[model samples]
Target chain A: MTSPWAVIIVVIYFCILGLVVGKWGKGKEKGLNEFAVAGRSGPWWLIMFTVLATWIIGSTYTATMGYAVMSGAIGIYMAMYSVMGLIIFYYIGPRIWVWGKVHNLYNLPDYIGRRYGDRRLAILVAIAGFIIGAPWQIMALKTFGYTTTALTYGALPEVAGMAIFAIAITAYCVYGGMRSVVVTDFFQGIICVVVVIGGIIACIYAKFGGIGPMFQQVLAQRPEMLVIEDTKYWTSIIVASFLGAYCWLEIFNRIFLAKSVRDLKIIARGAPILVGTVYFLVGILGIGGSILASVNVDLAAAESGLLTIFSEVGGPVLLAFAAIIIIAAEMSSIDSQIATAGVVLARNAVNEFKRTKLTEDRVVKLSRWIIGIWMVMVYFLSIGELPALIVIAIVTYEFLATMFPTIIIGALWKRGTAKACWASMAVGWIVCGILQISPVTQAWFGGWGAGITGAFFAIIVYFAVSLASPKDEKVEALFAEVEAYKEAR
Target chain B: MGNKLSRKSKTRLGFAIYFVVVIVPILALPTLNRLNTAEPFVGPFPRIIFLMLLDYLLVCAGLFALYEIESRRGDLL
Candidate 1:
């Protein structure tokens, strides 16, 4: 499994990435605005590509194959979440982008804090965002580390592999800020599309003797996978994923970076087709993995299904290329999460405590330092034995989904006071935590999913509390401002 | 190019498409369970597979058409 050529290819890949960092990293460290939002000048195509690339991460590639192997065609539903999420975004994202542009918002917390005129609620958002977002990044990095180590036959220790990934991602992201992340993401996105399509074609031809025979093998053996089940578990996951789209900080943050609301609209329009097609192709490969497993191809692990197929069908060179694609997906996602965490730390958390206003350069520097520190923490966490990638990803989505009510409802409702928003968020997390850990609830409604349960409770609490509580004049004014903006447009 | 709908109307249209193309098919999963039989639609492809593929194509086409119609208004973009 180990190949010196793989090592060589990886080293050269890192060098090319370093060159990209060097090119885009210049003069981007001067201000918090530049560091966090790319000066709000990203074109439509870059916005679309970066968003697409960030969505297609380790979970999409690794965990998805794992799901397919375990449950058959039901696995594609996991990938379909992103497609549904984008469609949901198409409705709400443009308005959020307009609000971000008008208010000069840097992150989600900034939006919530300003909308409610409550700094404490903003800080709460920042802390919650950091907690929910960081674990997923750790999961992505761990996936990259484990996959790379496995591919190289353990020539590099798992911890060391994770450390290398963390260091490289942190270096570029910290140095170049949002600009480098987006730029590198565009490149990564293109590579992901090409590799996924190429890998699918290769697997279909080499492994299954083309699409006809491929479907035939799957149909003849694992026919149950093709059947769509209507269990509460499946419905809950689909619903939560659609609602949870609003909760992903990285995806939400892209709204602030678009050159115009029109850019976001364009992205919303095009991303579903593009991302859907890519995942469909990847799903085909996952089906091929199932066929290989049935014939006793000795898959190393469930999550390694896609990689194993690539290695077997395409040989060492394609294996090496597939390894790079995994790296690309991991870096494209984890870097964005790290960068957003840095922004929250610098802008929302630290600035609240300092007496004097920090210089723009100082703020940017603090952000970079925060990114470095966060990545180190994630690297250490990645080294440990972690849960299944699908579990980790879904759990992260659940916790973040708790914030969905406060965000989406707050944007539309004038009665949504800061106190209610805070209380709703707290209640949501408590319910989610209880449902996730309690054996009784797990037995009763495990299929219903803790995330959807939390979201459902949070939405009710948000509406009930907001209605019962006194309305704030500030919120009313904010609503007026939103209306005025719409009228002007 | 000639279509001219208000933003409100366009929003309604978008939601309608979302319901018809995405939500309805998902809600129909229970009824569609009958199609899950192993009978091959084409060269050993299960009938359910073709149904899902058609669902996917419908979604893509629906969303694209929504975008095209909205873009023609020239006000929202």
Candidate 2:
């Protein structure tokens, strides 16, 4: 059985998360700026941790390891997707950072609004954000709930565990807003880093009987896990990485929170190294766990694979820390998703309700309500037991991959017409959506190819249409003007 | 416009492509296999520990290359 202290620690951790968020970005509740971007005053390290933690949420941790277990060596391709994504973002990010800092851009839709000089595109993007984000929130909660259950060894009902986590996250978010999420992220990030290091140590120690033997064993068992698959998969991993980089709102927002232009570069350069270390550690852990599972353990627990490995290998006490780590990881993601959804709904959907204006306070309140609704929906959806959580988790890469060209081109290419932006995003979103759902595509293309195809279409359509399409002079001027902001600085 | 890649930049670009295309593909391929090879004749080293230690070194080298490219492109600006 799992330890009781693990559950208590998680509960206490969240409460602390709530208190921290409420304290940092409170006292200025009137303007939307504070609620949305924390008055654009975040230090680089805090934002860095948030970006790192956000990407490695419960789904990421669980799914990546599960993938390694099931897919063996080929699974490491997913991390490559992320690496490519970050590299591409390096080019596009600074430009966005320049405009966002100058203009106080808050969310993805806000960028759309500014780029097109139209609230309609903003609203459209917001609606899409909610649709894209809602499913993710549920997935993260399922992870939080499952880890809690397993850590406690099923002392509490699964539903009860899910409900408790959902409520705690919701309460923290509602009370603290983005500030709370950031505060908790720092805590979660620290706990996660420590646990991951411990997990890596444990995995290494257990697998080879020591550091020396671990590699010998993994090499003896599955040496291929040590390398990449081939061109088709490697190329796919690269493309997906670039695409995955753009699809994340947390990354976008982190760039927005840069205290100076220099901070943006610092984050881009430094944050990746830190996150890469974290990813490599988890990836190594996955490799080790898979080697163990090959001997006897089952790989069917798709979401709880990491926890299962730790429990079996390290005993209950270390399992307690690991579970706590996973819970914190889940909360980091859940908080970000809820915040993103709330911002989207209030600014997009609720604003469209006609004649009702959304004040900052009202938007925050509505976001809290939306968070509750999202939690409930996700809890139910998670019960259905999706076919492959890793595939689903990485499925977002297809959506992101397709959207990346449009988002980057729209921001930097002064000649990029709004017509082309819409076409590209729409085509990318649609193609990726179809590929994700179609069984034929799933069977033939596998998880990796779907993203490449969608991205290819998006780029081709975006450019072809962009050249043929008429230019918006105002947008061209804005892009030029934003460039000057950097020059002047 | 004048801030584009120079001759040195082109050489660096070629090296990068060679590394990514030929070398990276060669390294990435064996990951698909189920059986772990204890063969000592592969690319740089045979042991996972040696590869890992080399990977860390390569990662460091890659970071340095990236820094140089970005610095030249004036990412700091």
Candidate 3:
């Protein structure tokens, strides 16, 4: 019943508490600063790694490989949309930071509200952020149960295991807020990197003699797993990815935390490499897993595909390590979702309803409650059959991608009128939603292709509407202030 | 006069290198695997090397792009 290695890793994992505890005195207990952005104490390198590790969750590890196993190499080709998205993150991240600090905006909705001077638009944006973000959190819960259960080889029932992990994530998030989450993230991130690289190496050595032999076997057996077929798929992937990357709430939240434009630039620069390193490693696992799965390997368990492979190939000890690694991976994103949801809701939704307004403590409390509510809703939604992992990822990201042009260009363009923001967002959302329901998404734009349609319509509507409408003085002033802030920094 | 490049020029040059040097190498690495000279090393290693190189190039290009975006928000439509 007891895996000694699992117990030890759990202890070491808790030992990473030192980072959070040490950061405690550094104003972590203070207002919104401590709860949301770690009081802006972290440097660019650490923040970059934290973001990368969180996004690369159990779903990323397990599902991507599952797809690779099922669809050949194009599964990774499908997942590469995320890589392109992160690469695009490197470009726009700094601008958000510059404007974030200048305007003193704490959440995505806060930025929108400031830009348009419209609380209603801000609320609409917040709802979109929350809706898009919730599926990813739900997926994490499913991954948690599936992965931990897989690691234990069905020692724990999937539902019970997922519930326990979800409970622990909620407890810590409630107590520590973003402060606790970031500290835990740093710990989980290191485990993720070490285990992924180690797993990939071990897998390659086990399956084939080495990397060379593995590819030869793959090339001999499955060639579709080795090459990209369509150039349009790649183009669509990159453009759609750029849209997703620019609009992600977590990335935007980090931009707000940045101390200066210079710091933002450094973080943006570091992110792609950090993300790409892990992405490349995961791609290797996909390649290796494709060959292994060809031998009728079942990737039925959701979260810890690597663990199933390790359990079979390596031993119980490595299985335990993979379990801990998957847990760490799941925690990284779960906590971020909780923290980001709390920040946006408190600032955009609940606070607006208050007379005297909510305190930071009250806001933190509300965020915790939101996390609980979100988990329960997600838990119920995931009870039956699961959606395709890549499909869920694309749908949610495509939904959020509608916000990209408004948020990114709205910050820089003084000529972008309020009418433009409203019209663009309305059109984009309606169009994207219609497309998703229409046969267009299924027939022509299946897989990574549907993403392009949503992103394309969003950007086009945003630009054209803004050009057609007249400018708002209030919006112009915000842009002017942003310019001054960038110069001053 | 020694030709002194402006920051804008440096950024443009960086973008150019990104497309030319970084992307070209990655795009070519797959072609190299077609040679089929060796087994494991031949097929995968070159692709991996190019990807790793592309990762570094992307990091640099992203930074250059971020800097350019921030400094030139006025110029952006």
Candidate 4:
């Protein structure tokens, strides 16, 4: 399932093209607003595309397909949570936008800092966010490296794949910041969906004839996978993923990029279609790959199993597009992470800690430098790759999942105090981390205990601590102001 | 009959629809879809995949209606 050098060249060409598109999208704004959130006047289309591009990460191309091949319909949890999450956001997003708009909040920790008037909590969460994103960047780099090597049939070294995309993404992220990320996402998102989905169709047609026949073949050979085997794990994954959907710094930042609450509503209405299509294609590849495993077991389980299937059937031409599309998706993801990490570190955490706050220009300069530091961190850490990258991704999601109670409650409940948030996150992080051990997760929870159960504990601790603590009048007034802002809008 | 519903009622209805959409895929669908594990094929997809697709479509239509309903001024309050 090796592709020719032509695929490698095409991938490189497209990466350069994406940089040009990103620079074009970067516009001429110099302030923090323009640099961080594309001036917060992003049209519905820009926000929609950027969200989709970031949402469908490299794993959806790689590991999720392997999961689908291993277990039937399990990856639907991936799709299910995404759509269900919108149900929460459709209601919650506007209020977040209102809060962000009203207080000039830059990111989620900034919102927390203002909401509770607690700088330490904000700094802790900000630092935690930057830390949580570490494994994520490594995972993305590994997936990038794996897919390029697999697609090129070992012509392209794994390190080269990681280095190529990481450098290009970091360059644009440093140069243009959020504006470049969103603009390039708009460019890459289109190529990703069209090429990846089209490649999926080509693979199905080349192999199992189509999705139904592929499923029929699998059902005839191994029907166990076709049915939901473990209901508890399945439901738990869906719930955890749904709760965790908006917990990412990039996701929270994307809400602020929307032009209006009306645009947020539009995003809510439209995202299920885009995200659903992406996941739906992943489902087809997974089901089809499940059958392919009977023919080629080892390749079927490879991290690039999905793209390998495309390369095997759809051939080098489709593999080139596949390589390009994945790079597009990966850059869309990594660039956002780098941009947000840099901004949060500089503006949210560093400036707050300073005696005299850094000027806006100095903050932007510091942010760019932080982006470089983050890329270096990825380079050093990813040198020793994790055995199971998706596992790291799940752990990354778990850390963010612990923040669910703080975010959802902070937005809605007036009584939610800073003390409650600290206690809630502490309990949630420890529970989730303990449950994450491989043997315990497998024996006790069947697979997905870390996130959903951890969130359950965090929610309880948040409520108990909130009820026990004296209600802060300042907090009550903050909620009143949030409500007033919503009304005035 | 639908036109007679007030804005308050419409928002409530929207929330109810959203609640159902969330509950189905998250809580109900996996268990319910497993009731028939014979793996029937439905329109180019297996039964489980078909159910997921159906659930996804329901969210699309349901959310769009909610958007239309909530886009109105009084519907949110």
- Summarize candidate 2's per-residue lDDT along A1-489 as a digit string, tens digits: 345666676567666765666676353554566666766677777777777766677755777677766555445554444444455455566667667776767777778778777777677767755665656776776766677667667777677778887777777766666777777788778778877877767766675566545545766787765554354565566656655566566556666665765555555556556565666666656666666644226555644666666666776656676777777777888787777677667766786565968776777677778767776677788766776764665676567677766567677576776677688878877777887778477455555577777787888888898889787788767767655885786
Compared with the true structure, what per-residue lDDT tens digits does model 3 show for residues A283-337? Answer: 6566666666533356564224566677666666677677776677777877777
Q: How much native contact recovery, as a fraction, does model 1 achieve?
A: 0.41
Give the lowest summed-lDDT range of ten residues in model 1 chain B: B23-32
TM-score of each model, paired residue for residue? 0.90, 0.84, 0.83, 0.91
Worst 10 residues of 2 chain A by lDDT: A294-303
B1-77, model 2: which lDDT tens digit per residue? Answer: 57887664565465456436532532454442322333563443344324443443454456456656666776443
Misplaced by over 4 Å in model 2 are A1-5, A8-19, A22-30, A222-231, A293-296, A301-305, A312-314, A352-357, A380-397, A429-448, B1-77
Quote the lDDT for B5 in model 1: 76
True contacts kept of 2: 0.12
**How close is chain B to the truth by TM-score, in each candidate?**
0.61, 0.43, 0.38, 0.57
Tens-place lDDT per residue, model 4, A156-222, is 7988888887787788888888888888888778778887777788778778887777778877887
Most DockQ-accurate candidate: 4
Q: What is residue A39's positional error in candidate 2, in angstroms?
A: 1.1
Candidate 4 residue runs with Cα over 4 Å from true position: A1-5, A8-19, A293-296, A299-302, A388-392, A437-448, A486-489, B1-18, B25-30, B33-36, B74-77
lDDT of each: 0.75, 0.65, 0.64, 0.77
Classified by CAPRI criteria, candidate 4 counts as acceptable
Q: What lDDT is reached at residue A334 by model 2?
A: 78
> Candidate 3 DockQ category?
incorrect
Interface RMSD of 1: 3.0
